[model samples]
Target: MLEGIRVLACGARDAVRLCATLLERAGAAVERTASDSADYDVILVSSDFDDANVVARWKTSGSHMVCDITATGPQDSRAGRRWSDAQIQAMSGLMDTTGFAHGAPVRIGVPLTEISAALYAAAAIAAAVRVKRMRGIVQNIDVTLSGCAASALTTFLPAAFARRAVGRLGNRHPACAPWNAYRTRDGWILICTGTEEQWRKLKQEARVPQLDDARFASLAERVRHVDELDALVESWTTTLTTDDCTRICESIGVAAGPIVGVRDLADEPNFRMRHAQAARAMKAHGVDADTYRDVSIFETSALSDALPVAKRAVPCERGANAAPLAGVKVIEIGQYTTAPLVGKHLAALGAQVVKIEPPGGEAARAWSPGQGGTSYFFALNNTDKETIALDLKQESARAYLRTLLKDADVLVENLRPGALAKLGFTREALGAINPRLVYCSISGFGMTSAYPSRPAFDTVIQAMGGLMDLTRADGAPVKIGASGADILGGQAALFAILARLAAREENAGAFIEISMQDVAAWCALFAAGNNSARGQALACLDGHIWMEREVSDAERAQCSALPKAVAAVKLAGATPVMRVDELLQDGDFLADVLSAARDANGAFWPVLKAPYRLTKTPACVRAAPGAPQAVRLAPPAPARAPVPEDRPA
Candidate 1:
């Protein structure tokens, strides 16, 4: 219980707010200060500001723990000596944003590690205060975002190096095969056969005795002839749907599953369970607080108890009063899923989102599975948003965009790496137009990369970033069915935009940039950690096989004879016989009988007994008169040029 402790927070507006909130939660008296004071037990400084007056003033103080929340590296006294504990912690905030950028040094999204570092800094200060009370000597602690991010690089940097210079492989592990995604009749399924036993079981279950033949008999031989195996597997899978293939493979003992899409995952039981936990944690973080907040830390010991404590009450309504961007307007200058999704979320939260498309409108407008003349693109990402058409390459359109930016609170774009500057809307130009505007730039790679000029798609990034490598279960790499990198990048952009908006309250002209490549690398790092611990390489798609051994001829004949008996019973319109005790018995006689029928005539038929009833209906549906007509939506208009008057101040 921090009963005797006090905290002095100094830094950027948000950092100060966060420090103060954390201190208050720990039961410390929090005071906002521009300069360090003698009475405080801890001084937390946020380092966005360039002014040195505060540091100069704090240097004279002794016997206090210091923490810095800055993106700048660890601080050193002007004399080139290390500062006290309190002084070091104050600069932790600035160090969080240090990283590689495409054109300029860019900050990461969410500053997650930075926030964690700040909390650790607080804990260190508290420990130091205890020591000073006992030994009468104050200590200093330094936490930098850069250092924290570097420490967080447990797997990311290594994986990145492995991909570029170390010779990256897609979904295949050099050692394992038959462990990748394969196309089925309707979709794809991920098949994993990591062991010889599992592989044999898979072949036995698929009823393919040829897999056990000498030439393709051993795992080594299978690896040597993976292409042939994959071709055969694909040919068989072409006759079955994804569900059918997965069921047949899994029943025998192969590790296999259908490749699920994002929407499909959202509805899955496991995803729902995880999401519920995450939602609960978010709520407990006091997200509804008008100011900053802290989340509760969970301990393993507490979780291991028979009866775990309930989570804290969730924060109250966050956006109940009004929109967070109530007076703000946004102009979305992006296409496809990644860039446009940012505007979509903001629009859902009540921002006035205006989607600007080119003369032909966004390519997504013509994407398939349209309803009422509305593409899934317009319906999904463009919901609650307005659409306008404009050709930015034309002087008139460019002039209009400048006008629109005049009143806009945020301008978001995801053009090719250099397209924005070529269009004369450089960061300087836009900042000049609206000093308070938050300009968010999204690109495939950061501006500082050698390949900054190169274009990238989700698949390419997935391959290059090591996602395809780690996703391989046996030896072949396979792409995740969904465009995970693109979607996560969009979420990252939204998160960065929100933080910048908060920062803009004080710093007014903050620029936010996000790279899809970085996002992919981060995700890959997480996957690689799992792979490294298992000491296995990625799975490959080319060596997958799904087969099963044939049943004995005697058994097969007996199984094949049951279908005729069942059919005769059905044709006679006779009530199938069944004892009540037989019905109560816990055996799969019905399934066996059905299988026998399928074996006999290549179709399943069941003879219903007294307890069961069946009904049939025509497939066609008749429409009633005066039925409501399906409404056909018109094509979205091209994006309009920004009106100069709307530029941000």
Candidate 2:
């Protein structure tokens, strides 16, 4: 969305490279040096560059947007110090929750701290650009890897204030039963049953007599004896192939997929289909992987110029509502974290999002970690959004969905790729109803790909996208502690929506597509920050450590526990290594960090500060889910309206 903009960047090689590439792909002209330009658009200076003269010059260049990529921002107590991804991840408390609880807390195989910082930086710059053209505003954005890493764990931060501790989860979910990997004849498969019907279906389809017992009859009971439950499920799953088990479970309504490894993901029929398509597309464009190693992984389609217009033509979703997205109205028709998170973020920014659910509510509502039958996951993602229950099996439910979309400014969905088009919500139908709507679809693969109809989940993407092999010291690759692929994919969807919104005045109707596999591959670049990082456990003075290294050994120095080793390598640098709980034990640290206090129920909880902020139109959280009410949405405008014109720049 940044066409005609000039980006002058000075930073570490990796950070600067990614930033410059994104800017370039976004149609921004990027220059490596800080040469003065009459219309200098953005200046990104890294913490690695401490040259006072260069920074001062860039600051005075009349740039519309300036961002400082640091380990910790200037507001932080630890600002002004250089950082590797390790130190930031550790202090952020993200690394503390990585790996199994039995194993020492390990660093994420990806350089998420840095990657998130870059992406946040990109998003912040994009938002600032839109503001500048709209109102002639200038923004100084300071993004920190430590801050980004901390924000990525916002879903878990409530534990801090609830007087609860967030610990390493390993692979098993604390709240959900039958939500782990099981041994199969050839390999392992992941089987998750979120509802009573699915569990019963598993018992009936697989003919597992053990599940007929009273102790395993209920979701709560199964969770109480998850180990035994796993054993019972595995007893039957072990006799089948990963494909056979997944097929059977899926046939019976259970969400099941294989625990894919790097090889399996690459060789999987669907992945190969997409890969072949990518290769052909790249060849057609004359872009060779041999030419662009780091940048090649981004889908060829995603790298295309997103927003072609130079000026901000659309009106900013702002006014007395006091939220950046105040006038925005979104209708989300999908389940799981990927699609709902996009709406959740929009709702947080003050959009009236009407979430469509089935008669039984969305699948996540029953996924456990509930209080009095209310799903915490659902509450976190669906808060402040109106809910409309519809059973699509009935034509009336589909008709009502069209009513909700009549005036929706945006439509976000992740419904198994092509299923939406087939379910009477075709593009032509939506276009006829709301021609100005910005449609976004989050899928496991692209709509045109051969495997678009296949079922995909976070673990499968992690395995196929090469995170598993890159995540550990041992050859066995593992999925991230959190759903990295899902959230990043969701964030990608959100980012694209924001871009389309910026240009909505010109092309109000746009279709943005996101693939979880593509996002996973993009996140894998995090490991590029530390080629030597094996995700192995290391001993620290008071705790364990995981380090993200500098690419080549000759330049960047490494840390070591031994003083002699320090003398050899100049070692004792502040990398984020210690366990998060151990670090939180210090009362002084708790008092100092930037946090948001939420009064949920009768008690207050703490969540980390948002990674980025908008000075004029800030992100706002209105309320939490209270009592579930049945409400009908107001009918949308039947006639298509003209795109709104820009008010100011």
Candidate 3:
């Protein structure tokens, strides 16, 4: 999709390498050296790069799309502290929300914050290119690891508002019962039952009559007695091998998968399938990874060219303070986090999004820790949009959806590979309805995947994507504390959509298929080549602090003599590890990252702001789930003649 585009990646070795890998995967011609002195379309620089003269020259050019990837947000850059995934994860609350209830906070295996910042950088660059094409606006983008990490806290931040401490639940979910990893004869298997029907199926599959107890009947009741529920479920699981457990769960239509280790990830059918497709994609561009060591992983630095400022073909439809996506209209058919998150971001940037939910609402509505009949979990992703409930099984609802699509600019969905098609809204059908539509689908696998019907919860993807293995604690695999697969995949989908939007031709539609597994593999590129390190946690007088590099016994002893903050301040090359609760007291973090948003119940809560900063057309959160009066979309235009088949991007 980025064919013929040139990108310069120069900065920290690891960061630049990752940026180059991603740009190359997108078909861009990437140059890894800053000394090339060649004009480029985009330049990505890391904060670690200290060449002041080079930075000054690039900034003055005003012709290239420059993106700076930093450890802190624009407001907090003055602190100038170096960071690693573990420290950022600690400060962002992701680490504190993970691990065993009684144990210390654990780090995510991968460099999550850096990876997230990179994705945002890539998306922002794509957005800038689109703006330049549409209105001749050139913008510099600033992406921060802290900003991205705060964004992922959407699912956990609401609890802080309620004065509830959201501690680590380990493999157990905070919301539902039978939603944890259980031990089997050979290894471990994860079982997740979200609905009542799925819970019944799990019981039947396990032949566990004890699950029929009244205390474990309702969702709330099961959660209240989750410990007993887990004990009962594990009894059945322990009798069988991991494979036996998985087979029975799948056979009964329960969401379950074996907890995969690193050595076994490459052998998984789904991972192998995704790797094969990636190889072919890269090979078409004359780039190929010789082995597993090659598959890899965004960001911005210099502006150089002066494309003539062009007049928009269409009249401006937004106010003077319009956001980046001010006039775009989007239709979102999403459940849970992946596609809904894309919609949330698009809405935050001022797109007019209408979310289509089932008549009974999406499954996420029932997730725990909610307020006034609304799930806080659901509110996090469904913000800044209007919603319509439809029973797609009914022709009338489908007919309404068809009409809604007639004037839509983008359609985002994360349903199973063929679920939408089965309802008669295939890519071809969507293209026929709106030749200008950007149809994007985020799925566990591509539409042509070998395992179309396999269940793909976040747990399953982490296990199969080699994340669990890399995030092991004491040699035992564990999923990342946060929904890494879903968030990363959603961000990737957004990037593809923005790229397609920028390269759009009149009456030309594009189909974007993003596989969660593929995104996981791509993000793991750097981490896959390096040995997994969970980071060192040093004991302090009052609490603990995290450091990515190994700390000797003497260093630990020195730090242990002081409080966490004092230790961080006194110890050379140390910073305080923060928790989600600490965000409430962080002035700088609160200023740029957190915003107050009212939920459907009129209760005010904290939510994350946009993850990137665009100088000209910045992203803003104008409204949330409960707010009314979003950007009023234009009335449906008269249907136009259908165009040729839309091609996939």
RMSD of each: 26.2, 9.6, 8.5
Clashes of each: 84, 9, 10
The model with the greatest TM-score is 3
Instruction: Write the residue-wise lDDT of candidate 1 on 1-649 in tens digits.
Output: 3556777776553334544564565457887754433487777765445345665455346545656555434332222222211122112211111211111111122323434344434434443443344334554555444333222221122222223221222323334567555778886665767678777776666555566667567778887877777666666777889778866875665655555432232232322332344334334541233311212111001111223233212111233233334455888998876777677655544467777788767765654444333343344455546677777777777777888887787788888766878999876687667665667777765544435434455554554444454443233345532344565566556655543343211444546666665555444433322221121111112110111123345533443345423522333221112211222231332321111111122332222111110011001111101111222233456899977686677
Query: If the candidates were sorted by their TM-score against the true structure, best first, what order would they fall in?
Result: 3, 2, 1
Report lDDT per candidate.
Answer: 0.46, 0.62, 0.72
Identify the candidate with maximal lDDT: 3
Residue range 519-576, candidate 2, lDDT tens digits: 6655553343235334234544445544443223432222234332232234334243
Q: Model 3 lDDT vs. the true structure?
A: 0.72
Q: Give the per-residue lDDT digits (tens) of candidate 3, residues 1-649.
A: 5666788888673445555566676667888765556778788886544464675567568888777777776467433455666677777777776666766667787788877887777777777766766676666777778889987876677677566776677777777788887889998888888788989888877778888899998999999999999999999999999988888887777778777654455555666665655455434543223333344321110111122222223213444456667778899999888999999988876788999887667776776667665677777788788987777787767778889898788899999888998999876677666665778888876666657767788877776666776776556677787888899989888887776556533325566778887677655544655544556667787667777677788888899898888888776656566767777888888787877787566677556778888877888765546522223233455789999898998
Candidate scoring better on TM-score of 1 and 2: 2
Candidate 1 has a TM-score of 0.38
Query: Which parts of model 3 have CA positions greater than 4 angstroms off?
Result: 13-15, 35-37, 208-218, 277-322, 360-376, 504-507, 532-534, 552-562, 597-605, 627-649
